[model samples]
Target: MTNLKIALIGNPNVGKTSLFNALTGMNQRVGNYPGITVERKVGNFSLNNQTQATIIDLPGVYSINPTSTDEEVALQVFFDQTNKDYPDVVVVVAEAENLKRNLLLFLQIRDLGFPTLLCINMADQMQKKGISIDIPALEKKLNTKIVLTSTRQQEGIDQLKSEILALVNAPTTSPFDIKTINPEYFSAIEKNFPTIPPFKVWMALTQNFFSTEIPLDKIEHFRQNHSIDVKKIQHKEVVKRYQFINEVLKKTYTLDTTKETDVRMKLDRIFTHKIFGYVQFIIILGVIFGAVFELAKFPMDFIEGSFEDLSNWVLDTFPKGKLTDLIANGVLMGLSGVLMFVPQISILFLLIAILEDSGYMSRMVFLMDKIMRPFGLNGKSVIPLVSGTACAIPAIMAARNIENPKERFITMLITPFTTCSARIPIYIIIISVIIPQTYIAGFIPLQALVMVGMYAVGFVVAMLAGKLLSKLLKYKQESYFIIEMPTYKVPIFKNVLLTVYEKVLSYITNAGKIILALSIILWFLGSHGGENYNNAEEIVTQSEAAQTMDKEELEFAIAKYESENSYIGKIGQAIQPIFAPLGYDWKTSIGILTSFAARETFVGTLSTLYNLGDDFEEQETQIIERMKNEKRPDGTPVFGLATGLSLLMFYAFAMQCTSTIAITKKELNSWKWTAYQMFGMTIFAYIMALLVYQLVK
Candidate 1:
């Protein structure tokens, strides 16, 4: 079988992703490019019985000149011949209505002397918008084959695939001449680098970066020998390319303005309104979050109950031993903590995907820029901040889209302040226990209001942190913001599902690994300890309190006593004093510590600690009920209003999740900044929790 590699390239919002999905359909895998945080998407497909192809979806960019990391990644694949993702053929997807503007990138890629094919996408919209294209004439002018595709309608996809296969064997040639822009400069470049393409050499010189294939010393020598005006040359190059493009487009393309409608403009007017825009965005968020809670409750309960039953079954079916105990009480319990919240996470991703697909997310970014610019962020930062609500790991990675180093760093540092799904379990359990269940004004649930309040607090704190960091961090580059307003359309369900699937799967895999490891380690620590643990039964049985307790109560007391004397118990005891002022007892201290592995593990840790026993009845108990009944040495409740609120405040601001820390280090590529973020957030969290406890208590 013949194997081929294809690079799919396009501008943002050009239906490139939809085409990739339609071509590959569940055969794709997403990861990071070599050493960068920019996402890399690859998929495999079979073109014929004896031929197979691997397609790489390069980061979307406007032109070969790079302004952001995303564009740099895209440029690298084309420039670096030795790159693993370097393609045998390049396919540039272009929007049908915006062919002229899209061709700028297509032309640049074609001029690089690659066998390139232009796939004009969204062809279904051409007639509705009264746009007509002369495909044969355009293809002849551009010196490439053109395939009209509507990924939504599955039109012309087979033709696209066939053209791709044919292009693989086609001869490579440049359609545009670099010497046309500046003959003297190109002649000099060709003289210096005879073996290399002048256009590639020009790109390296103008972009101020070069691939491994180019000799850095030679390029540097040439630059020092010749006085080059990079900006002026870049402007000249753009003008030259567009001059050719406009002439070709005029002969081959036509759009009847009289046949077009102003619906898009009218919709943009309302959606982008200074006053109404913000109001609509807020309402949309409210509905989405409200749906997240309401839609997830039934599935969450089912998952919770199912896990409980499985744990009990493991206890009953397996011989009573350490392994069985670990599986039942440790792994299963911890997995349940995160798995149960999957419904809520999935729902949130589903809604966010729909918003993004429908083009409303861009408007939100545009609207929020006015608010965020006062801080250190731009419209791009809105994406990472909004994404942070789902998971901080990817949220931080999403900050790669922000071109400004200062704003990107600020976005990474402050994004964790937004409430993540990991914190959802923590928030829900705590709110349920402390906040009233009744509704306000006989309509709005007070619990829901508090939940919204928590989200608001995170956003407000993130903004304040951004403002502070903007002043603290020093960078001289001026920030610029430009966003595309994609024509709003019904979200493609396949695309939405794929996005939701990938994100949710990532969330589960990351959280599951940490939770599973910590659960077992926590169970072992809580299961066995020093001499005190071994003598727990004797100590509890002989106590005065045991004298009044029944058999079941006696068993529970002994189990509790043993857990407190266990290794984890001793560790908790050592940390108890530090958190005592914040109203967290030794047991709750254990939960807080385990939560560093994952915030959701707080519930699991408490479950394992409070329910460590051999009694069958005790194994069926719920963590919330046990927590409600818990009391300190003085007979006061451990989870009172003040303590619950304190815990909520701490988790809200604390940098607890290790996954987030690792990704932050990877994205920022600085241990110093990572350490600063970790300790800074943690200390602030402690101070806030302490104050809240003291004031509320």
Candidate 2:
């Protein structure tokens, strides 16, 4: 009859979030808390006509006492009773294949005294592999209800929902009936702090009493009454808990080793070989990047044209004024912001999801460990590099698995150099305008070939940077890459669709909001300025009297003045001398600055600049021609080979995504590192651009 909060909690790679997505559908919102890196995902679904339930998908963690930042966020929800609303029922999702390993967290949740249900996921995989679970027997043993689910097949979903609904009425159960820890120590803790839950006290002890300050009176009582050393006692209790899990699994599960070796081992030998493994890994990654770039072009062109037509139509229907300018320049630009990257981002996520689902990503990590070691990184940092191609933010967060501090810090520092999809829009716009479209080898467009070359440059440079950093930073920690290569299975269509949906929607929700706000603010600045800037028409008329200039010349001069005097223009001018050696004018300088917000803003900024006096479609030819024929103070073309090459270098290496900065801050555990990344990348990009510009010029 009312709403309830249900949480899906589990260790990483157990498909907890997948189950949550299957249940919640499109009713979801993603954002962060005011002061945390943890992504809070809450979605609502109705269990019946009379009752609604909200599901919270917390980040995956091994245990409540966390060593990693993400794990700490998960632990906060579990440990902080002061949280406004704790889950009404905890669904402990565990993989049926790795039941024992997964149950470690499940048992811990049960000890928290929540009304709990054990969800044994991946049931289909178990059946296919000739593994089976006696669900009722296991449920009775743990004293908890069980739901066998295969989220990929949509199996047991209805039954799971019904069980969760029933949990609202079922009494809470202590499934992790602790029998291993010394009873005297547990008794002493409970007796010392009368109000503190016995389980919380035990968790606090296991975590070495981290942040758990008992009242002064309770602390005095405990110290006076007992002679236990807290650290030594806590260490002994943790060992005992794992010892208990090992014993429980011994009786309950059986594995067929001979059958396991049939395919999984045979595959692993080739996939993780000392020499061939790294080679195979590189080939796989190259193919993924190569395929997405080629296959996504047709759809990208279609979307580009569709947005152009849409903007033109809007400009035609609306009368010219401040409002129409805002619609054509601001809103259309914002929608284009959302549309332009759909093809590349969609294909990227599709490929990544398939690899991740098949568990090939893990194998790739293990293989790359040898190479990554010399670069101050281990196998786990490979995900961040791969993900950085789509966006560095998620890639940076994925570095959570890298336990080594020095390696992780370097991984975060260098990930921005791995060309991301945000850079795609910048590459497309510039390559089309500058790189000639004549056939290379009388076949492929030279422009497209150049774009591909630029991407390769970014990848090569990123690896080289990583290797150099590894040598410079003297780390002697013994680090190795251990990975699990799961059995191959057909990628579930629903899971693929859900993953793409979530990633794409996130791009739109987060990046779109930033672009929309910036575009409006930019429009206001370009439209209304003080003194000679206020009236463009009058200023152009006054300038035309001296030379009897043509309409195009008069308009160009007026546009230059308006851009120079606008608020953003002042910023561009202030920074222009820094870029002037690279053959960039104030306008190009502004594009570079705005691009850090997002690389897609390159076209949007350029469009806004020229479209101040006319519609975007109408000015497309003029804008291209202006860039082509326009000259510098030294009378050289503004966009010759020199400036074009320079611009490409800048976009290729720059730290150009705001979302990435936010994520880096979260992952590195400080704004200090985020600042270092931004400043370091900017200076690096500037130097590379300068050298390229001078050589070409």
Candidate 3:
């Protein structure tokens, strides 16, 4: 089979991603370009039986002229000057209605020396918008194969594949004559190094590519030794390129000036209206949170029940010992806790995908940008801040697009303050335990209100932090914010499902690994103790109170005594006093400590701790039930409203995820900030938790 790499590159919102999705389907993987935070998407497809190729969806940019790190990566890879991720054939997707504007980028890639295909995407909408393109004239003028494709219409893909497969190395026509534009500039490059590709030399001189394919020191030297005014040369080049592009597009494209704006604009007016926008956004968010619980109820129940049954079966099937306990209360319990959240998470991912693919997400950025400006962040920070709701690690990574270092720093610092999905498991379980299930208007769930409140708590905290940080942290750099609102279209089902599948699977798999290992270790710690645990059976049976108890009652009492004396109990007792002010006993304290590995592990820890050795039966138990039944030494219910509310507040504000902290350290490249975030957030969490508990108690 022939192996090749095809890069899908174009301006943002040009349907490049849609085309890539059309070709690659579910065969794509998203990672990062080496040593950069920019997302990299690569996938596999076969043009023919023997013509298998990998397609990379490079970050979309307006031009090869680099400003942001994202654009730099695109240019570096296009010049075949990257360590890896160089494309064999560059497929530049352009909107048929806006070819003139899109051609600027296509022309840059064409000159940088690569076999290229120009795809006029959204062709189906062209005629309706009174747009027309002379395809043959364009192909001839640009000296490339131009394929008309409507990824939405599923048109022209097969022809595109045939063209790609039949292509051979071809020289670029009208490749910019650098000498004509600036003889001194060309002469300086040739004089220093004649062997290098002219464009590479031209690009290297104009701006630092900072690519791994070339030595960094050599680029720096070329930069330092040269007497080039970079901005001046870049300006001259842009003028010269546009001079050529204007001549080409004059005859090849036409648009009707009287074209009517589509329904998208009509909808955008109301949705993006100043007065209605925020109100509508909030209403949608309310529906989403409420629907998450409502839609996930059946699936969550099924998953919960299945795992519970499995745990019970494992206990009965295996020989009763530590191994059996480990598999039942540890592994099975942990896996169940992680997987149970899949239903809610899947809903969240699916809904988010719909909103993003439908192009409404950009409007959200537009709306929030106004609100974020006062908080020291620009509109661009909105993406990362919004993404924080999914998971903080990726959200922090998303902040790389914020061009201003100060703004990016502020974004990264406050992003974790947003409530993430990991907190949902924590929130929902607690809400179930403390909040009544009564409805307000016969349909709205009271528990769902608590869920929304939890999210609101995070958002408000993040906004306040942003406002404060904007005042405290000082850095000087011009921040840039520009976003394209793509023409709205029906979201592709396969793509939406693919996104949800990848995100949900990633969440469950990562959380499961940590929880499973912790559960086993915790079970071991909870099962064994010093002399107190060993003598529990004899001591409890010999007690004068046990003489009046029936056999079953006596057995349960002995089991309770053994559990309390276990090593895990001793550890919890050691830390119990510290959390006593927050209404947390030692057992709850242990749950908090275990959750440092991950917030979702809190529920799993409680499950493992409360799992029955004596009450092993076919019937299953819920975490809420076990927690509800828990008691203090004074025989008061352990998880009352005061304790549940305090715990909720703590998790809401605390930086509990070690994974998030480690990622923050790696992304920010500083352990000091990570340390500050961890300790600062935790201290705040403890104080608030204490306050809530004290007032409520």
lDDT-best of 1 and 2: 1
Q: Model 1 over residues 107-191: C-alpha lDDT tens digits?
A: 8888777899999998988888889998999888988999999988999999998999899768666677889998988999889
lDDT of 2 by residue, 193-281 (tens): 66765666666544533323444455555556666676675566567667766766666666665444367767888888888888887
Q: Which sections of candidate 2 miss by over 4 Å? A: 25-34, 45-51, 132-136, 165-179, 194-197, 206-235, 256-261, 298-304, 373-380, 387-413, 420-484, 528-575, 580-652, 656-680, 687-697
Tell me which of candidates 2 and 3 scores higher on lDDT: 3
User: Which candidate number maximizes TM-score?
Assistant: 1
Worst 10 residues of 1 by lDDT: 612-621
The Cα local distance difference test for each model comes to 0.83, 0.72, 0.76
TM-score each candidate.
Answer: 0.87, 0.78, 0.82
Measured on C-alpha atoms, candidate 3 has an lDDT of 0.76
lDDT of 3 at 307: 90
Off by over 4 Å in 3: 35-37, 70-75, 79-82, 178-181, 210-221, 259-261, 378-456, 467-478, 508-512, 550-559, 580-591, 594-649, 656-679, 690-697
Off by over 4 Å in 1: 383-409, 419-455, 471-478, 509-511, 581-588, 594-648, 657-676, 691-697
